[model samples]
Target: MYELKTKENDRSVVEFIENVESPTKREDAYKLLDIFTETTGYQAKMWGPSIIGFGSYHYKYPTGHEGDAPLVGFSPRKAKISLYFATGDTKREELLENFGKHTTGKACVYINKLADVDVAVLKRLIEQSVRFLQDTYPNNNTN
Candidate 1:
């Protein structure tokens, strides 16, 4: 059995944002908190030590691996902010075209700052990602 290291915890989201080394990043983190909260309509929750996540969903693979993950989240890292979304969603790729400046990784979108991206596009990405995950996993594990 494989264990998920980044399970959700009761840590303080505000405290985590307050401890960010860069003042700019700290401010951006607060902004992101507000964006994700208003867009997702879910209160922010700390995932693992760094990720500020909104709503959560449980996913089980055909190989029998199962875990709970946030519908959308972000982390204000040192180099760039990492945005988490559903993997393998074609809609995400399409939206990124008009998302302003950002780079895509295996499962995240990295951006230097909120200003470099269009907030409207970001909200759409959040909505689409959450919808895709809910439709794909249709289980009762969503919150």
Candidate 2:
């Protein structure tokens, strides 16, 4: 059985943000916290040691692998901020076209700062991610 390392925990999100070494990253973490919260309409929770996540969903793959994951989340990392959104959404690729400056990986979109991206587009990405996960995993508790 494979274990999920990013499981949600009881750690304080505010305390995590305040402890961010970079003042700029700390400020950006706060900004992202507000954006994810208002957009998802779900309170933020700490995922693992670094990710500030909103909402959650339980997923079981056809291969019998199952785990819970956040609907959306972000981490203020050393090099760039990582934005976690649902993968396999075509709409996500389309939205990234107008999302200002950012780089995408399989599950994370990296950005230098919130100022470098359009906040409105970021909100839409968050909403789309939540909707995609809820629709894809209908029985999962995504809220």
The number of the candidate with the highest lDDT is 2
Give candidate 1 regions above 4 Å deviation: none
Query: Stretches of candidate 2 above 4 Å error?
Result: none
Candidate 2 lDDT over 1-143, as tens digits, reads 67789989999999998988999899999999988988989999999999998999998889889999998999999999999999889999999999999998878999998899999999999999999999998888755
* Candidate models: Cα lDDT each: 0.91, 0.92
Local lDDT at 138 for model 1: 80
Clashes of each: 0, 0
User: Roughly what TM-score does model 1 have, to 2 decimal places?
Assistant: 0.96
TM-score of 2: 0.97
In terms of lDDT, model 2 sits at: 0.92
Candidate 1: which pairs clash?
Answer: none
State TM-scores per candidate.
0.96, 0.97
lDDT (10s digit) by residue, model 1, range 49-124: 9999988988888999988999999999999999998876898989999999999888889999899999999999
